[model samples]
Target chain A: MATSVEQPQTLIYVLGVTVIFLASALIGIMYLAQIDISQEYTLYNIQYSSTVSRMVNSPTCFALEESFELPEGYGTETQVQAGIIDWWKFNSGITKVCSDGRIIYAYLSSLDGTLQKQLLTGRDPLTALSDSDLESIDNWNTKQEKYYVLVYKDSQLIPAILEVRIKG
Target chain B: MKKAGGAFLTELLLATVLVLIIAAGFFGIQHIPGFSLEPEAKALIQSVGDNEICNVNLLNLIRSPNEDGTLGDTLITSYLTKDYTVFNETTTNILNQVMLRRWVMNLSINNRVEATFGDPAGFVAVPCIAYVPLPQPFFSNCSFSEIQTGFDGYEINFTTPDGNVTMEIVNQFVTDSDKIGGFGVYPTSEWTTIPETAIIGEPTTINDTLNADLLILQIYVGDESEEVLIPYELTISEPSEDPDGLTEVHLTKKDLVQQCSIALNLFVELNNE
Candidate 1:
């Protein structure tokens, strides 16, 4: 009779543990809700500065998009005249393209999957990122700041990330 | 007692999680991307604005009637133009094509910097357009509602109370790519140089900035070159607005920097890396 009573109590303990795990996971998702979406890019076919000048003289991109689900719809990949929009759309931040299209990802400092109502901030990253070394990791301050990293493989955008906190 | 302690700990964890969520909502997301501007970039943007201001001042040098009827000695003599005729628009376009034909006009290093901005004809006071609506028969199959001119890109005209007023820009161009190294001119008596205080330099490059001559233009090509006009006498068109509708009439330096930074940054990122 004691053993039978103990089994019911243990079952209740397991149920409580499962509920706690789900709640904790939900909280984390909510905390890191926003994705600083950037572009997955490839090198331009033309000369650098000229491309930049011509891009500035061109019209603004005619469309906007919002999605986090798979096969995420970024705009049609076309060459622009090397401007701010190009920078954001072609950032190879976190999730990268693999040889066979499988994604090899890294941790980005951001809240995962929780934002709704994404706004058009229209902030340009290049105006701030003038001289930062692209290939280094130390430039990132995981505590005070984080880089919103965009990743690309085979010249395609995958998931991006931003470091929210660094554990010492 | 042990069970009560576990439940208490669980409650504490939940509270912590709630705090994290709220903090992220308020502060965390915005700072990540928007605050990335470097000090150098800010300085460069400011220089670009400075250049645009200098350019606008040059336009004010000619004696032109203000929005009021009073005369002001601005670089632009007047915004008043005759209503554009189809033929006049065609001729002006052809002239602009010739005027804009890129070539190196030479100068000695000591030549005075000569710069001006606006519709070329407005400064020159050339009467080019006259009102003549499409005569009698309209072409059934055509896209030519109005005769288009090359200078149209440089001009933006809108109607105001006294009469129709138009504004335009005249860009200085270095035509020959090869001779750019020693390309220059010695100031002649005809070239008018603006004061040192007013100079439109390249926004970012120290090398590009100078008390260089007020930039000038020459129509080495067509008869109608200096005669292009855009009249705002009609009431259909709406006035242009800034990116944010918070203001009227002027596009602030902050606005251009916002535009240029976004454009050039994207260009560099996409084209180079």
Candidate 2:
């Protein structure tokens, strides 16, 4: 009779342990799901935003800059204007100076569909690799396209779109 | 006692195995593609995309090139010509390449909507707004002047004795005669006549000289009515060339406040990621 009673008590203890384990596991999964969701896009977005900012604001990129003669013994000074694309510089591949060892392709097109320019900067690792190699990595890349960039051409401010594709 | 102990150990092992199997299944379901956190991830992406478009993209689209002129220029031209093909196509083409979201663009002139692109029923949201002033239209030779003068030596003949009498004659668009003829010239092409009312008296018949460049206002002084004729000459000359470079009316900022402006709105819908 004592053994039978002890058996039922041990069974209750096992049931209690299983319930606690399942509850804890569910909570752990919920916490991990939140982190996974945020981690997926946050890093990509940060990199994308940074690349776009540098491309538009940096003089070595497509930014418009003007040179003015300085007075006295001072040398001429250059002023870089943000949010303006120098049409001549853009067409002349001056943007090649913007290559900073990363794979990026910047495309610009006038809203009127009359003008388009594409520049590829950085190393072309994928070009050298075989198709099978790319497929192995799942062909990972992030693309961001923005509108309302002003292209300064012939004393006119032309509206345009700039698309940047970053390859990982 | 040994038998009971053995059964207890077996039952504990079985319970442990059952819990492990359930946990494994739960984890497998979570790892399935798009099964966990898809809605949250989608919402975040959509929010970022929309914010960029509102802050940066719409501004550029208005300033971007459309054809022989900027996109804003094309919009104005399209507004007047009723041919929105160029503006609509240029904008849609640029946006289509980058975005999959459905959108609608509304162009309002002087607070009144003049052109709309995209289906009205497709999307609903507060639009991204941008304003572009219409290019000022140039008129070579156009003049407007109003000369208020009193009737001098002109006949003041009113047949009414008592009560009130009023007469008004408005001339629109100065004709050749009004331009070549001297001060009393009236427009013959477009003339607006006000019906005269002579209360408590017969219909007033005034002389042609009284009708020339004159507006008669008869006021009642006690029982007796006194007639007064005021002379005013308004001269409006049509432009020698096209009046408004874009349209027929002379372009003025005051007139344009309600009729001619390029106000653009872009309403975007969230696309499934």
Candidate 3:
């Protein structure tokens, strides 16, 4: 009778050890998975910030005032250059003359938020990005970035915001 | 008694087998679809983070623009006379401490400015020391000699073939002890020495005699080059009435590229402690 009682106790002890071992293994796996996910998110944030910084510092964006040629109806070369600068002050347009990317959209607006222009490549204001993608830009989180550059507007240099969103 | 011992040992063996099976199942979950490790993602994140840090550090080394949008004189002197040994040591420490990697910093300036005025001459070439990192045996295969002891700051001496253009970038920090406060570029050739009084409390001038229609100063920190341009017509005259007047020079958007851009690249490896 005593031997029978001890047999059940040994089985119980063995079962308890097995349960503890299984629980420890499960927790370890979960911890590793969490670590990996955290690392990935950190990396994504870094890439996003770097991309935005690069766009803001691009030389092409800074040299936008000197990028246009004299349009046919815009007087002489000097007048045309001046006209382009003036137009950029209030008008939004896209230029095919991009150094790195396929298209560059230059958005111009006055400080008082009076005038707005959106120029698209090929003289069409439409962009290749879907409406949803463009709308997403309005709801940019801290990850997305926009740079406001001072462009020539009349005699004063006004601020023009340049937002670059590259989609595949 | 023998039968009882056999049964106990069998129970222990069964428990061991059960635990091994459960552990295997838990660990094998990572092998499931969409759960594999992404080494590329981790590397991309690390590289971008490293590059951004390097950019910030390098920009901090440059002189800040004054209230009037002109670089100060002391800043220029410090820039010219900055000890590379100290710079490299500081940079390496920051990078290693922050990044936990063995890395080196390389600096090279490319002054190739195209003439936008007068006769369109070719690029004005400023000879630079090739990419040389401190503590030899790392990036030792460089064309130009490393900075030696007792060496004065960098000197950029260039004269166009026509003798019309003569430009000299002397180490003002070493030459003149008094002009040591602000940062700027004072054109001091063998024939002409710009008085410190001219730049004191005045807008730093890009002398009209330099004949440089456009001057692009490129600072390369690894493979990346950040260029700042000094255009053909950037002259701010001294105030006639107030000798202590400040000349406010307006900088266009084009000038901001050089001032704001941080272009530095560094290769970082994970430090296995």
Candidate 4:
């Protein structure tokens, strides 16, 4: 065979192909990495005001049944009176896990400069969820009767609601 | 020797290319899970919940009224309609006005959902953390339901296709109850003696031709974005010394006046209306 003469030509072809291939590969890799983060995020807010109007015309049952009453330290006049309590932030996430392996989580977000709250404990762990139990609090199921699932990101108000009950 | 060296270099290049291909495939496969929509969508919801919390809380604080003259009920109505209530007093006053910060609210609703898809019927879905208040006892089942007077619970009505949830919510503020002692239920044009109970003081009713003046429990609802244009109603009933003020501080028990009958009977309607 014509060994020496063909060697350099073959090397040139290989070099050209390799360059194009690596370029395409890099583009594909970066595109894949960004796919999950591309979509616009919608925010779901839950707010309340000392002003009754800022509170929803109708509150979720958990709060209403509780008579809008809070503990002395839970940010009320009594708590402030005690002079021990300091600041307060509208909280969201897991509250308590029932004995029956049910989970409950609270979701509070902002809407039109007011606090609007959403509460739920959804089940149905993603089939893809591994046993690894990652520390993704924003993600992950609690131990209460997972009821509602808020589907959104960050914008103005809560976006969508999905049921989170674990069914057979 | 030169040929040997060249072959070695060729082998190294081939190995490196192979490794590159394997690594790319591995990483490419790892990304498939992230592409799935559910987890991302859920995370977005969680983030939205987190992002808006601060704004809502601040809004709540700004909208809350102070003790000097701008009481909560007044400022809250003002806030509903977007009326900016400027702090008339200096910052020192606000900081010193400890009563202004004492306000808190909680929520409780009677959630009635009729489960149809092979589940139990008349199932109620009540959420407790929806409280606007920190300490939650004030908002009880009675208050929300209008069943038990002091916010006992909610009355839930539900529908299916799109579950129409009708609930009564109880929002409460726990002031220093002890300070609000001896609130004489004197017959202020709005109260009356419950027929049998002899009022300690001579009862006085609004002499004018008012409708339902015998009961008084004023409730007002205003469009939250506008400050001035608000709609409210004053209700009055057999007025005698009654629990006019709700305070949480320490106070001497002068003499117990009256109590809003554990009945949610108070409604807002005027003679003209």
The per-model DockQ list reads 0.02, 0.15, 0.05, 0.04
* Candidate 2 accuracy as lDDT: 0.55
Regions of candidate 2 where Cα sits further than 4 Å from its true position? A1-35, A57-60, A66-84, A91-101, A109-117, A123-140, A144-161, B1-38, B53-56, B66-68, B80-86, B97-100, B109-115, B119-127, B134-261, B269-272
Stretches of candidate 4 exceeding 4 Å from the true structure: A1-9, A12-140, A143-168, B1-8, B11-43, B65-273
Candidate 4 has a TM-score of 0.23
TM-score, prediction 2: 0.45
User: Candidate 2, residues B1-273: lDDT per residue as tens digits?
Assistant: 677666677777766677677767666766877576665565566556565555456666766654556777887777768899988888887667545567777888557777788767864343678777655442111111122211222211233222223323233322224323233243222222433433223214322332232222222211324453222222222323221211111111122233335778888775444
Off by over 4 Å in 1: A1-168, B1-7, B22-53, B56-78, B81-273
Per-residue lDDT of candidate 1, residues A1-168 (tens digit): 567555655655565566656666775566446432222111111122122222222323211123233322333454422111222332322111211122111222212333111111122322332233222334433221112222223433222222222111
Each prediction's total of clashing residue pairs, residues at least 3 apart in sequence or on different chains, is 51, 2, 16, 106
Better of 2 and 3 by TM-score: 2
Structural RMSD, model 2: 16.6
Q: What's the true lDDT of residue B188 in model 2? A: 23
Query: DockQ: which candidate is best?
Result: 2
Error of 1 at B192 (Å): 46
Instruction: Please report the candidate that would top lDDT against the real structure.
Output: 2
The digit string of per-residue lDDT tens for model 3 on A46-87 reads: 545544444334333333334345533343442222111344
Could you estimate the TM-score for every candidate?
0.16, 0.45, 0.30, 0.23
lDDT of 3 at B250: 19
CA shift at B207, candidate 2, in angstroms? Answer: 62
Model 4, global lDDT: 0.28
Query: Where's the lowest-lDDT run of ten residues in candidate 3 chain B?
Result: B142-151
Candidate 3 has an fnat equal to 0.09
